[model samples]
Target chain A: MANKLVAHMRLPQPISNLLAARNIQTAKDALSIPEFDLMTLLGVDIEDVRDALARISKVASPPYQTALSLLEERLINDASSGRLPTFLKGLDAVLGGGIPFGVLTELVGPSGIGKTQFCLKLSLIAALPMSYGGLDGRVVYIDTESKFSSRRMIEMGRNSFPEIFYSEGMAQEMAGRIIVLHLTSLSEITESLQQMKLRFLQHEVKLLIIDSMAAFVSGDNERSGSMSRDHLLNCPFSFLKSIAEFSCIPIVVTNQVRGHNNDGTSQYSFLGKDTDNNSEKFMNQVPALGIQWAHAVTIRLIFEAHSGQKFIKVAKSPISPPLAFPFTVCSSGIALLSDDGIEMLGQEINVIRSQGFFSIFDAS
Target chain B: MEVSALPISPTNKEKLISAGYTNLASLVIVSPIRLSRELQISVQEASNIIKVTLQCSGAVGLDGRHVVLRGAQTAWEMFSDEQNLKHISTGSEDFDGILGGGIHCGEVTEVGGVPGIGKTQLGIQLGVNVQIPIVYGGLGSKAIYIDTEGSFMPERAYQIAEACIMDTLESFRFHRKGAEDCHERMQPNYFLANILYFRICSYTEQIAVINNLNKIVVEQKDVKIVIIDSISFHFRQDFEDMALRTRVLKELSQTLMKLAKKFTLAVVVMNQVTTKRTDGSFQLTLALGDTWSHSCTNRVILHWDGNDRRAYVEKSPSLPQASASFSVTGKGIRNAISHSKRVRMM
Candidate 1:
């Protein structure tokens, strides 16, 4: 809609001819300003350019009225639906009463830091009714790697609520609530996501999970010497962002790590090439995706493993500090460390409620 | 907070005396006695009753003795000061040598790798081997396996266990022993106790499985090994919002760390990887991000060199970083797959 407006500015025919000579397509394209790079080719910097563009970007009078009606409808739906909630026993202290219904929470990690375990347990929790640390809704998982297992889910679920895992009926019931889609390519995900709203409503889905968002670009698309590959790979992420916004359903994306060269020596070294050198030096040699990818994520949690255990650090979160917490991946599920496993697990809800991770959100 | 400060009663004082509190010092040492003493007494009376009043706050350690006056106020203070950390044993002597004995009770460690690279195998190996007592370089508890990938082979666990216990078993009178018997016998000696109490299960029964595990650890007071085959399976399947995904991850990690600490157990985690492609090239990396990277105390990546297995010391909090190559042989985790050369990290 914003791109459609053409009321910005008019350039002289001679200037347009010059822009054409320079291979510029549209008047808007000719604007060479950083904000409007293609414009400079037309040799036009008319005084009213910026204001005219702004005016065109604004919704027209009729569109504004229509937009107001749509906003009203959305607000009403949001209020009435009481969207699914996330239950973090101690995290409410930082998150202010679970994760809000419509936002992304990126659970980042090195390999084996229990990120996937944490994700699995959350799916089980989301299946339970609201009172039992769940949102009582269906969940959809988009597995880029085809690693979803019902047996494991049942195993983890059995102890949390035996009936949910043991009862044969539960398989069907859970199948209805938890959906897993396996895709090998990013195009499939993007195409499917474009129709997510209809599918979600049809499936009664409340949660949408992308096992590794980066894989949609990183894995499915082949990396080559062509610049077009980079743009094509990035297209899926843009579409994912839009999907999350349009559906008002929280989207979770897992990302793979790229070796960073902390030092300048191997800045251009391809993946895994610098392992022969001092790993620390090799890591110092590479860099991450700058600020572009960072700006897209609202929350980012970095997971690491120490001595075969998992720890979570809030690398970037809009609501919490960057504190690291220890974790365990046990038969039950992922859990925060407690003073006493005996006194706290299953025996004391009030005590569990008092922990930092479980405390009531001190919302401002 | 105001009502929390109070005094003791004469009857409570008598109980303290009966519990072996000879003087004010003894009374302070056994703080719970103060609560007993002040049961029905007014705050003023209890406050004025003791010879010297001092506020005892923070963690305390006892002499490892069971004092009858464990109920005393002073003892409570002493309890607050005590810091006890539990640890899990890794089978590798070199790895354990670097890890300051093993995975500590309250710390989180992460193990990462691409699928088919032996992440689960390592975790399973730890489960079978972490059964020796702490003094003997073990935690002496049965292991709990949370298999997320459905690749948790009970047969493999049995194989690992049999290998670990190869030299410990006495010749059986019954020559009828078969694979089932080996499996039954290969299990850690305490397996029965753990099962009788812990009810170790899989991720599908995650909640009940954990509750039983907690029961085993807390009630039996001996469990020490927990293995979650692949932590990513369920979480990746559920939770749409990244923030909520993290919160949930935090909750689970926190719970496990607390349990490991409280019960003196070792926890092992398995991870899955995602492949990243850029400009006609591809690289495989662990799914998830910085939250996971920093939360763990150790990180290891398992990769394959053709048919041979290679493991790297991606990160270890206190240990010097190193990588080793090994093969999945019939015997179990071996230093070398065969006569192949060992590549040591400098």
Candidate 2:
């Protein structure tokens, strides 16, 4: 195998001989031991140790891809057209037919306004037969909140696909196609995703749905370190992005929203910025995990609620407009509202702005 | 207890035992830096070995993250288990009532406020209150206090410990009337000594300390609470990259969340507030940006409301959006008035 690490290192003869004596065959083994220790244990010179360590840190990054090549690859890939549709007409229209494949889409909202219901309907759609407009592939749904209800999945199946749910055996087959994994801690979720890279190829999963991302991050546990967040978050989520892009699978993740005020003093972020996701007057609910998290996704949808009315906003998307769509959570699954228009939404925003709620930051 | 039980590579395993660490318990107290020196390996590699061994005594469950196909649980079992998880009191009745008990275990709770508005005081009080004997309606477990701003005063802790001990004794007296008994480890010195304090000087140290806390907890075995006096202190300065700060803070919070659940500890993080420029004025918002607001399971904002200190439960899954008045008295955290009712906001 050419002793991959040694071949890549370009180490001098004495240092390579020293590494051999110490049984340091791989680059990982060399990197795993401190440099000072390398000098004492291997009896190698400081200059050679520095050269080896520097080479390890500076030389080993993934090969860079050009924008043109990526664009060309996507253009010719037939699987790029595999966008599965949600049966709701209004949502399908706003989403430009359906949710696209190979993109990271977020469902952001407050607690319990049918974020899970949206995911359920999507899972059901993704698992449907190709004749019924689905991708005709399996789904991997990672549920961290332990709120994955098989009963609700069956209900959504019966509600959206009448013909498919005709028999108990059919339901069983559909259930088997959708593999639900219950994970609680953040470490567990990230580790499972790492292992799923292998299971993904075997299962031929077309859709990867993490019921909620913010839940596990804040809702679960792990260790700390000198390593920056850039290094930490980049591994799992960007790893996920690569997985989705490589296999042409659409990845869906749900996020929780936190209500905050618009104090322009804070640094502004252009990532996933929707000009009017929430006006300054409506308690200003933004997506959790901040602007840094916004950069990791390709699309962001906000499931908002106000004065008894429900709204699903296309807060961020590469191909969709910055607009809101009214929707309802039915017993079967999530459905769109009967009458939804840009004019009605504009009026609602105007009314919310006119009635000034007491901003309490002044209490300080 | 043997080094043979660690889920590490055989070569590393041989090096570990050769360095005089024959058992798992011996590795618990050995810092990663020392282990690296002793084993002639990198600190990262040393921590890896220690983490593998400390997670479990037997190799049967060494990969404790359990990403593998472990058995699943029903909602009923989760609910029953949650019901039995006890909370560490905030030392105030109204504060405890509005909090659904006190600080919840197996979750991260962030308390934010301007400087000197009792964030440190509340942090110290929780550190003391966690040591209240389990028989006296407390968790009775030790606390790990990571002080970033050097504001954690030992004198304040001693006073709080005194109050906690007195309260335990008083409860013991009341329960003795009911023909019940209490744990004898209720002395003031015992409570003070039980708190493990770490003073962090730099942002990297803060992260490194927290990253290494899992090893410390494995040795201690009874840490019920981990308090970061101010999680945002080091990240707020000299960092030109705003996006980098967000990712770092998010990752750190995720680590704290994982630690809390794995060990069933209440993680309380104190934060300082930054002023946000509003229309022709400035408003005080929690520091580290809006994204930092969602880093905790519950967000409590402490502020000065007409000279009365108030703690607002801004965000919680099970509690209402309410604020209650509490005081940092000479003893510890206590009710501001005889009847400081929960002020429900809409």
Candidate 3:
């Protein structure tokens, strides 16, 4: 007699619920190969293999239909919850106090435009208590360019908590809450962040910060597949969105603007390339998903350097129109300058621009 | 044949359950009006669906964005503990005292100044001093220094090290044997030579340096203090693209914040000043633009006034904003303004 062996796997709770709700004998029976095949054969409803995999991985429900519903509900809940991070105060206020959670907020600008600085400040501010314009949570920072400096953080912390600088313990206390990871590739970013979220489960991390998302995509390497690179860049933001939907964490990403034209001009295009060297040649904006990022993101912050100061403008916000703020860098760090300083910086920059004096534009 | 009733149009009950809304108490938290408006079908429809979801499905409730489960209290406690476990500070009257005790574990603080204004000096001092316990709140740890400008003087470090240790003039001298002894003692007892538990690196190698430094900060259980002397050096040199430099600086700022939080180490960054040419005249400014300004929690602008010294508190998270003058003498940083004020009163 031939030996008969059968493999059985218990269904997840959601799958069991889906099967039982549909009055199926078992989850296996409910999702029987014959039935799934029959549905495809009948052409009554289509089954997306990739989507099915996604459902099986994320949803607990047995029935694909129920899992789809759960996914939709989760997506909508994430969108409406307003957990996405907006890096700047102006950007957040315009975005109804914050960018929608479970999505992405991208700060884009040319070099020296304050994009990275804005990203760092957002990370620090996001971890702060709610009263001080923070969501009071933890943060996972992925640095592709290898630019994190603990000394800078301590110096920044000293401004707020002076004693923290003089005391190692206080520095540690402040430092421990920040989870920083450096990755050579964009792929490592998403995986590291997922693991970090699990490790610090209880800390309601309000933000996922990727300082200069462009670093993962662009560099000296002969990396091709622009779409894939963009998707990879967007991966961590998507993960943060999922966390934000369930745990309410916002994801903030900074992007470095690329100069499309080789012409010796100091002007920049934030999203895309320009066909001509003329300012009117500004074609479109480039981001993780062409215009998709602008649409999917609840807020867009554009940082521009005027004279010696950085001007933050709300390039795009879901709830508010664009506004501008002038910021200055001193020995201690960045500061919202007095109106006089802002005007002065603005005027000084105007003079430079009118003179058409171009500084050597080198991309880092 | 009926396609599972097409999921019942996601009725009021189904909506509540899917939204993680279960009981009336939890429903109220997300805004009763919004819930009521959403469930406008009928009271019976809402109640029946809720009953079906709760009794049959055993789904938890939703209070706005939060999923209301039974173990929420415990989860919240765990979250609070992770968020609030802060390190205390040493009672250093000038620096530590200004910070309400010590450096916090999860924040970014900036120490900014022009090149000669002693940005790295303060950082080096902290690197030597931050060697206590958590209760006393020191990692009893050494430091990892990233020297962008190549100006890190081992002699100066040795001098400070001597003060923190034996406080003898002989020990502070930069002799070959004294330097060797200081270097050996600086390493944790368990660490080996190649392991170089403490060292300094340059600016161009900052990315590689930070990557390695992060590992050291993490693996060492009781290690404390990570310092970057002049974070702006490479950024300043790679200044052709202000935008790219901003990105690098931001990346630096974000990574620093994360390491500080992950390791609970006191991270200190020294910043250099840049000369901005305006109207063909040059005015000194901090490099990296608003990126540095916005990212830092505290900003210390240091300058020289004739023979006196000045260090102004430009920004702080939990401390009052004030300019205080202090002198760095053989004994370390001492408050000059306070003494002068008292002298004037006398």
Best candidate, lDDT: 2
Per-residue accuracy of model 2 over B1-346 as CA lDDT, tens digit each: 7888777988889998888888888888889999999889989999888777766754344244343335555556668878999988898988898899899999899998754456777888898898776666778788888876544545456667888788767667755552244344666667767777775545655655665677678888999999998887666643457876676677678878989989989999988765554455345577788898888999998865543567888889879988888866667788874423422112
Which prediction has more favorable lDDT, 2 or 3?
A: 2
Per residue, candidate 3 scores C-alpha lDDT tens digits across B175-268 of 4443443444543221111112222222324543553455455554554566666665444432355665566566557767877766766677
Candidate 1, backbone clash total: 147
| Candidate rank order under TM-score | 2, 1, 3
lDDT tens string, model 1, A218-328?
A: 433223422343344445544555555555566677765554433322211122455435445223211122223433455565555433334555544433423455566
**Per-residue lDDT value at B42 in model 2:** 89
TM-score winner between candidates 1 and 2: 2
* CA-RMSD of model 2: 27.2
A354 Cα displacement, candidate 1 (Å)? 31
Task: Rank candidates by lDDT, best first.
Answer: 2, 1, 3
| Candidate 1 per-residue C-alpha lDDT over B99-191 given as tens digits, one digit per residue, 9 for 90 to 100 | 566565545566766433456567766766656433333455555556433334333455566666663343232443443434454444333
Candidate 1 has an lDDT of: 0.50
